[model samples]
Target: MTATKLKPTLGTLHLWGLAVGLVISGEYFGWSYGWGTAGTLGFLVSTLLVAVMYTCFIFSYTELTTAIPHAGGPFAYSLRAFGPTGATVAGLATLIEFVFAPPAIAMAIGAYLNVQFPSLSPNVAAVGAYFVFMALNILGVSIAATFELVVTVLAVLELLVFMGVVAPGFSFSRFALGGWAGSDTFSPAAISGIFAAIPFAIWFFLAIEGAAMAAEEAKDPKRTIPRAYIAGILTLVVLALGVMMFAGGVGDWRALSNINDPLPQAMKTVVGDNSAWMHMLVWIGLFGLVASFHGIILGYSRQFFALARAGFLPPALAKLSRFQTPHRAIIAGGVVGIAAVLSDGAVNLQGMGLTAAMITMSVFGAIVMYIMSMLSLFKLRRSEPQLERTYRAPGYPLIPGIALALALVCLVAMVWFNPTITVIFVVLMVLGAVFSKLVRGRGAIDPQLATEV
Candidate 1:
């Protein structure tokens, strides 16, 4: 049999999958797990801040993507913008984030699937889903992309139901939120509670900037990218915050905390014990979870495949499919994810499974790269002013500058409270730095790529 590589164009299903994946994994499941129903208001406010910040960043990335449409997103951009050393470090950190993310998300899917569908064993369901994800990758990007669109629509519709009709029925005045203030559950509740509950506030908006990674596959790098980015982000926010607020208004903080899955439990109170609606709503939530995991797996596999192709990881990990997709890399990435899930399932490991730390590090790494990329922009303007730009950042220095500063602050805040994880981030940085140099001579990115800007 002969082989073939699938040629994908911009603004396709694969592109949509990349963006929608970020929103669901970043917002829907991430927030619900961290902040709980009672913290809806606070979580929403923080998320709004993140959303606005990331939206601007996405625009900046869109401009970059249009200028250079390729598979390796930040790595490609950073190398062009920054010098070799700088870009290499950024790429490594990004690779870490994308690689580790699959397991964390897969684990979450396992937990939630168990919660909603008690019939299937969690491990079996998780392992099955992981394999299914691998198969989906092999089925080709066309099928995967279509699934992304369907999943995205389902997630959005579910949110509308929760917020539009159900949320407004309850009184917001009755909600009490003094729990974090006056409570005395001193046993790891303060730090761990925030870390544990951090899902609500932190995970809600994890890797939104990853949308730019799929810019090459987007319909129109200039138009579809920005519009879809705005619409997609807004859709998630309205759903997550809206449903959360509905849940909060329907019941008090005490009631919300007691229920692990706040959305369904809260809906039951508002709907007057309607088991049918609860079951339907809970099933939708699970569907959203599945969609999210699907999206995350896509991102991780693309990253792994992309990095491997670029010569960062092993060459065997970089092989492409007859369909032009990175089949071997995707399968390898899925296996790693399955392993993480299998181990956790056996040991009963819980609480977002290194997600908190992974997110913290990824965001921090991205912020650092953003700062470097911005600086690289200036360097490019000075060093290679005549270079062509397909899409220029609207407010080059100003907008990029603000993004850099905000990212720095976010990174700083994460480090302030998360020393344990911060140290590990340091170790990853050192290790990635070393690894980048190892591939520099032959397989790694050409130093000239960085200077091309």
Candidate 2:
């Protein structure tokens, strides 16, 4: 468990990149799926509600990240507040959230590529992404972070370009067509659709909290985390709403609802499929997916390294490579994601495609982790009042309370709508619990590591 520390090479900009990049793929593809279930206006309502939760959650969660400054993130906070069992839940949830997310983004990356190259297979591109990014991560934290910053900037710009290109064709009349759960007027079905759309709404900001996993490697985390998180959330809110509205307005919103590459398809409606703008969006759009996919690899590997270092998982995963990166942990997560990628079509859930199913499962883990994180924030406030908190959550009880309540509601809605994915998530949690218990009983964890947390 005694491994080299993660190098502190990340600053405010790098943290912002990681924060936004971790969830930017949501802007590109997955959130549009909400359109399928909720229609344009219904999914817009869902997005606004989830946006409030994340805005509050990030503000409150930043307090923990700054105070604890651990690679384990929620796991570390839970360990300090509620001990091993809480840590186990937070750790596994974080793991599941980070691990499952990339495959979804990777699949989107492949889909975006397939739009450009007619014969290319999405599965092949998705699998190829795992190897390329894992190697970049293994080289060094600074290099990985610098690369992340570059791609994140490009992705942000591409989104802006997309909005500009589609603005001329935007028609509120078109967007409102079947906008309320496939109905002109709101009804019981609209309510159900909004609830069912919660997971996809959450997809818009799912891994923003994963930036906390980089706390251990951040320069002056207490100062950097707040600025990065607040700015990142604001940036995403603008992009998510803009992309969804503009895309929905150009022609039939329903056409873009269920597919993986919504932006390109939406753009094709304005510019012909052969237009230069269409080609550019397809090419640059990959950066959005690549940003999230690459960033999540960094996020999940840190969780694996942190859990293993704490003796909650295999000790071998804690080892750092010559580059001071958690190479083993990175590869371990990549293996799981690649497996999910390979099983894309083989394991279908209801009528959901592999990407939609994975997005739901990832959101399931995220909501659990969000609830646990808010609980930890409350517990720590009461138990460790003296702990140095350079940045306090602005509203205290109100802000975190809102975050916790909304997270619970999202969790319930997701479970109700996606029963099969819920069962699979629960089973994974149970298996992780058993594994953690066996690992702990063997006294495999270092007492020093426990004391440090």
Best candidate (score: lDDT): 2
Q: What is the lDDT of residue 350 in candidate 1?
A: 26
User: Model 1 RMSD to the real structure?
Assistant: 4.5
lDDT of each: 0.59, 0.92
Encode model 2's per-residue lDDT on 1-453: one tens digit a residue: 265488898999999999999999999999999988998899989999999999999989999999999999999999999998999999999999999999999999889888878699999999999999999999999999999999999999999999999999999999988888845556889989999999999998889999999999999999999999999999999999999999999989888888999999999999988999999999999999999999999999999999988889988898999999999999999999999999988977978989999998899999999999999999999999999999999998999999999999999998899889999999999999999889877877675686476
TM-score of 1: 0.83
Residue ranges of candidate 1 with Cα displaced over 4 Å: 1-6, 10-17, 33-41, 179-202, 219-223, 254-260, 272-274, 345-384, 442-453
* TM of each candidate vs. truth: 0.83, 0.99
Considering summed lDDT, which 10 consecutive residues are worst modelled in model 2? Answer: 444-453
Q: Which stretches of candidate 2 lie over 4 Å from their true place?
A: 182-185
